[model samples]
Target: MRALVLAGGAGTRLRPITSTSAKQLVPVANKPILFYGLEQIRDAGVTEVGIIVGDTAADIEAAVGDGSALGISVTYLRQEAPLGLAHAVLTAADFLGDEDFVMFLGDNLIEGGIGDLVASFERDRPAAQLLLKQVPDPERFGVAVLADDGTIERLVEKPADPPSDLALVGVYLFTSAIVDAARRISPSARGELEITDAIQQLLDDGQTVRASRVEGWWLDTGKKDELLDANRIVLGTVTQRIDGDVDQDSTVTGAVVVEAGAVVTGSVLRGPAVIGADARIVDSYVGPFTSIAEGCVVTRSEVEFSVLMQGCVLTDVPRIEASLLGREVRVSRGARRPAAHRLLLGDHSDVELAEGS
Candidate 1:
């Protein structure tokens, strides 16, 4: 089966960062999230891939080129507008002609990979198979109701009251039957063709719909908090290694990965962290669950659980935590000044000034 990765969203939730970079390109453990999805697709034994791109098409193209580097041939499909998931599938119809394909949301992170799911689908040849996970907030996701035979009976997109806690995961396996379903779907009240509506049409028409409950971690990195959480989750699985220059004065604890060209001097870095290529850390404490991207600098500053993108500078800053800083940002010491609140007294009321001043 071929893989169709949806890379067209505007990522409004991750503003400022998404204003410049695509959400799928955001790095976790120094690797772009999109790359992770592509890697997963490659691992699933899919060699032909089609990436759906929108306004950020150029950037996505520059990053993922021919996909040959990852052992997959890629075709870039452009979407004119940010319509909906079903719209994306509709646009990719020509690329997916007559072949079953796996659809992956570019920003979603699935821990183990979808090799098993693809294998099962290949064996059974179901019309559509959805990955499901039990989430506490099913109202925020596409909810699915299953039949007694363990098949999907119905599905709804972000219902006010969910019928089940089984939320749809971002990975979906579909045959060419979905193309017809996509065409038959109408825009919902929200004025977009919802994918849940398309899937439900298939279920109502007596097409086979299957569900696979995922056992591994799945994260939708839509907002700042979820982005940081994805970073933490990925870093936790990293095994500590130093393939670059680490000075004698530097100490790295568990699960740290120092890429080539990165240098650390007189710094203590806790584990489950990554230092990207050409990054420099000196006289600082790099804490856990943090990813310092390529060409960044950390000097005499303490940072923990943060994602510092390329070319960031932090000097003489006491502490930084839980932040996703964009590229070329500088956080350093400000001009020295005396500490006090100064207020002007109007005529009759006189205020005593500090003794030193």
Candidate 2:
């Protein structure tokens, strides 16, 4: 089966960062989230891949190149707008042709890969196979109702009252029959072609649609919390490989990976953390679940459980935890003499300040 990876959405939920970069290109453990999906597709023996690109097409293209780096040949398919999932499928119809394909959301992360899922599809294929996971907030996802025979009966896109806890995972396997279903379906109230509606059309056409529960973690890194959580989970699997310079005064512990050219002096790096290439950490504590991207700097500061993009500078910043910072940001301790609140905040932003500061 061919692979159709949709990387063409406006990630408005991850603003400031998404304002400058593509969400799929965001690094989880120093590797782009899109690369993870591509690696898994390669492992599944899919050689021909089509990537759907939107406004961030240039960034995605630059990062992924010709897909030779991922052991697959890629064809860039442009989407005029961020319509919807089924819309993306329609856009890729020419590339998909008559072959069965796997539709992977570029920003989704599924732990342990989809090797077995592809194997199952190759053995006994269905008209459409959806990956399902039990989520607490099914109302926020595409809800699926299953028949007694473990087949999909109905699907709803973000219903106010969900029928079941089973939510559709971002990865879907579909046959060429889905192309007809997508074409037959109408756009939902959201003004976009809903994949759930397309799948329901398959059911209406007397086609067999199946659901398979995900055995491992599945993450849709749409917002800040989800992004950081995915980062933490991915970092847990990273093996220790220190290719950088760490002074004798520095203490690097646990599963930390310091990439080449990175320097750590008089710093304490905790486990499951990575200091990217050319990054510098001096007299700082780089705690767990944190990724300091390439060329970032941290001096006399402490950070934990955060993802710092490339070229960020943190000097005497005291302590920052559970945060996501964009590239080229500089956070420094303000002058004590000023004793004023100088702020430029975004919409719905929350800030806390010490008394008398």
Candidate 3:
């Protein structure tokens, strides 16, 4: 079986960051979010992969290349616009050909990979199979209704009154039948060919559709909080590995990772946390669930539950938690007497300042 990975959304929800970088490229635990999906696809025994890319095609291509590094041969399928999931499948038709394939959303992270799902799909050979998870807010996702025999009875895309709590989990398995289903459906009210509609079309055409419940976490990293949550969950699984230099003045504890070339001095690193390559943490408290990307510097600061991207600097910052900092972002306290906050943020940036700090 082949794989079609969609890395081409306009990620408006993660604005400012998404404005300059692909959302799929955003790091969770110092690793690109898209990379996790690719790795899972490879682990599922699917090496012939096609990435559906849009405006961020160049960036995704530069990072993924031919996908040989990840044990897959990648073919880039250029989608003219950020249309929809069904549109992405339609765009990758040539690469997918007549084979059964898996469609994975690049920004979605599923724990434990999709090996079992692929195996089940191969064993049963259903016309289409979907991964479904019971979500608190079914209205926020494409939901599914199941029949008595556990077959997918119906599918709805962001319905105001959802039929069930089973939300689509961003991983799909399909035989060639889905291509025609996608073509047969019209654009939804949102002006895109919805994948839910295509799946509904399959049901309407008397094709077998099945769903498997996600036993592990399924994170759709589309917003800031969601991304941070994903980071925390992924970090919790890290094992303690200190490959970098930790001076006697520094104290490290728990499942933390200090990559090679990173230096920690007069600081406390409390894991599950990761200090990326060449990063320096001095006289600071790098708290739990934090990922400091490569070349970053943290001095006399306390950071917890945050993601500091490559080249970010945090100097004399008292405490920062549950935050996401883009590359090269500098957060330093000024020596001015007034002691006021200063911020130069990009479009759609969200910041909360403490008064009288």
Candidate 4:
């Protein structure tokens, strides 16, 4: 079996950040999200993989190359536009050939690897297997309805009123039969060929479709809040090791990873945080769930639960949390603006003054 990783979405939800960098490349624990997906795929014993890329194809190609370093040979499939998930599969048809494949979304984070899922697919050889997880907002994701016997009866994409809380996770296992399903399905109401629609087509044709409730943590790192959450989840599992320079005057706590070339002096680094390579933190507090990317500088700044990209600098900033700082971002003290309230009064109305009223 091969793997087809979708790296094509525009990631509009990430806004200005996605405008410059691919969402899949966004870092959590100082590692790209796409890299984690690739690692998981490699761990599943898949040797050949195809990555479907869109506008950010060049960057993705440069990062993965031949995938030799990751123990896999990568073939790049270019999708001119993100027609939909099904469209991505259609684009990778040539690379996927007639073998069973696993499709993983680059922006999705799954705590447990897909190794077991791949093994199960190989054993059962189902036409398609969908991973399901209970989510609070089922309306925001593709949802599945289970029959009385616990089989997937139907799959719906972002239904306004969902039949179940079991939302479809981003990982999918499919056999060669899906190629025909992709060709047979029509575009959804949104004008894109959704993967859920194809699965619905399979269900309509009485094909075997299975669903598994995910048992571990899962996150879609498409927004600032989710990105921060993903960072905390992954960083919490990393072992504590201070490999870089930590000054004698500094105090380091649990699960802190100080990469080579980084210098921490007279500062306190809390647990489950990472200081990237060449980063400098001085006289500040690096709190929990923070990731300071390579070459960043934090001086006299107390930051917590924040992500600083390469070359960012923060001085005297305090209580920073759940922020996504782009490269070259510089945070410093600013002059206080005068506090005043302006009101547009009606022609015949009198505005009350604070002193009198």
Measured by TM-score, the strongest candidate is 3
Give the worst 10-residue stretch by lDDT in candidate 3. 337-346
Q: Candidate 2 lDDT (Cα, whole model)? A: 0.92
Candidate 4 residues lying further than 4 Å off, grouped into runs, are: 335-357
Runs off by more than 4 Å, candidate 3: none
In order, how many clashes per candidate? Answer: 0, 0, 0, 0
lDDT per residue for candidate 3 within 1-357, as digits (tens), equals 999999999999999899998999999999999999999999889999999988999999999999989999999999999889999999999888999999999999998999999999999999999999999999999999999999999999999999999999999999999999999999999999999999999999999999999998999999999999999999999999999999999999999999999999999999999999999999999999999999999999999999999999999999999999999999998999776777898889999876657
Residue 265, candidate 2: how far off, in angstroms?
A: 0.3
* Candidate 2 per-residue lDDT over residues 7-121, each given as its tens digit: 9988888886788789898888888889999999999899899999999999999998999978999999999898889999999999999999999999999978888898988
Error of 4 at 79 (Å): 0.6
lDDT of 2 at 161: 92
How close is every model to the real structure, measured as TM-score?
Answer: 0.93, 0.97, 0.99, 0.93
Residue 128 displacement (Å), model 2: 0.5
Error of 2 at 281 (Å): 0.3
Segments of candidate 1 deviating more than 4 angstroms: 338-357
- lDDT for predicted candidate 4 compared with the true structure: 0.88
Q: By the lDDT metric, which is better: model 2 or model 4?
A: 2
Kindly indicate the candidate among 1 and 4 with the higher TM-score: 1
As for TM-score, the candidate ahead, 1 or 2, is 2
**Cα lDDT computed for each candidate against the true fold:** 0.91, 0.92, 0.95, 0.88
Best by lDDT: 3
lDDT of 1 by residue, 1-357 (tens): 899999989988887778887989988888889999999999999989999999999999999999989899999999888888899999999999999999999999997999999999999988999999999999999999998999998998999989999999999999999999999989988888889999998987899999999888899999888999999999988898898899889888899999999999999999899999999999999999999999999999999999999999999878888888877878776555774444432222323333573
